[model samples]
Target: MNTDIEIVTGFLGSGKTSFINALVESTLVDNEKVLIIQCERGLREIQKTIIEDKRVKIKLYDAEKPLTEEYLKYALTLYRPHRVIIEHNGTRNLIETLNIFNSKALKKHCKITTIFYISEASVFNFYLDNMGGFLLPAVEYSNLILINNINEVGKEEIDKIHKKIDSINPYAIIIGVKKGESIKAMVQKEKILEEGFLKKLRIFFKNIVYR
Candidate 1:
């Protein structure tokens, strides 16, 4: 089976990890071997250890290593994962990674399922005010927008964020959710599965690693 690659993206402490925690929890009911590959700035061992499921595999990458195209190609080749989830570094350039995946070699192996951006409603203004820092190109590239932490930010703010996300990239699917929810549960499979199996997958991704 062609592995499904879903990229879940977001800013730091925006409940990206929390969202994944629940996602894998639900995934255990089905697939036993789910992989979560995380790229962050500091020691996130506690978070890494927390996602320790017999079914889930966690790979952590910190410290500066030359992030060349060959590095990613090798990782994709060796891992041979059923579902590959990447927790991207916010400051990291996503286009570079996307361009690498654009290769025919990768396209033949993994299918790009979805790109989900987890956003905290409270920081919508903060990110908007600091647009350049947020990487407009990456945001524009995402396929889905997940507005999380509705309790902290409130429904009104969520609505505003929706307006903001739509203004930025109208094509991305927008889903409003709490901080922690299962990956399979958050993505309403009914709507997407309607398109058929060849086009459906479940994965998590992120864009922000830190401040």
Candidate 2:
């Protein structure tokens, strides 16, 4: 059976590790085997307790080394995991990593289910300016974009950021999250956002195409 791959990416200190840890703890039931390929070390480490689970395995790779198709293929063949999660480096080009996932050889073994981009709302604009075009690919390709540290910014500010993100990738499900928020709540929000967004987008496209 093909493994399901989830790519979690963001700028440095964007809470990708925290989000992943919360997600795994809450949703991964029934001893589901998970293989986590971490390309960068975050400010916070995933707790030792999470790793103690027999079903969860993690491999940390050097961020300087390119995450090539050959390496990914070898990892997949070796682990044969039920699901794969990549904690991608903030500085790496997301498109390049995604290309490896898109390769024919990798496709036969694993398929990418979702790409989640976690953005720290407070420093979003700074990164956008400093990183230049490096950040666009991840935002454009993400299935969901979570703007973390929402409590640090007001709703108006968050909305502005949301609009900016929407302009780039209207199809992505965007949500604002404060600390201590439940992942289940975020998942629920995604469902609602996706449904409403898709409905409107479909109507708008239909009108344009028909007109």
Candidate 3:
């Protein structure tokens, strides 16, 4: 059986570790074995107790050294995990890391389940101004874009951030989350929006052609 891989990426201090911890705590109870590989060290560390399930393992690597196909293949061989979660580095190029996963050797053993991009609402503009080129690709490639620390920012600011992200990746599900909040409700809301948008689009074209 192939391992299911999830890539979680975000800029520095954007809450990627916190989100991953919450996800693992809420889910993955029944999986046979799971592995979390961290490519960067954050100011805060994920506690062992939070993810101390007998079936789970966590590994941290140096951020300076980029992830290579040979190292990834070796990790897969050693862990033989049922599920794999990658905590990607903020400064690293996500495209390079994605390429490693796309390599024939790793692709045969693991399949990408989803790529999630998390952002801090308050510093979003700064990131766009300074790191836009590096960050845009991650936003475009992600399946879901999460704006964290929403409680600290105002609605207008949030809207601006939302519009910017939408312009880059309209198909991705975008959600605003306060610290320690569950993602289930936000995910459901995204689904409703997607359905409504499609319904409205069809009606819009029908009216234009019929009239």
Q: How are the candidates ranked when ordered by lDDT, highest leading?
A: 2, 3, 1
Residue 141 in model 2: lDDT: 89
| lDDT tens readout by residue for model 3, 19-109 | 7776565555443466899997677777677566777888898888998888878888998776788999988989988888877888888
Q: Which residue pairs clash within candidate 2?
A: none
Q: State the lDDT of candidate 2 residue by residue for 92-199, as single tens digits.
A: 999889878777888887888889998888988677767759998988889888888789977788777887788899998887888778654776555532234453
Each prediction's TM-score versus the true structure = 0.71, 0.83, 0.82
Question: Model 1 Cα displacement at 124 (Å)?
Answer: 1.5
Q: Pull out the clashing pairs in model 3.
A: none
User: Once superposed on the true structure, which residue ranges of model 3 sit more than 4 Å away at CA?
Assistant: 179-211
Q: Poorest 10 consecutive residues of model 1 by lDDT?
A: 202-211
Model 1: residues with Cα > 4 Å off, grouped in runs: 28-32, 41-52, 63-68, 132-134, 154-156, 178-211
Summed over model 2, clashes come to: 0
Give the winner by lDDT: 1 or 3.
3
- Provide the lDDT at 184 for model 2: 49
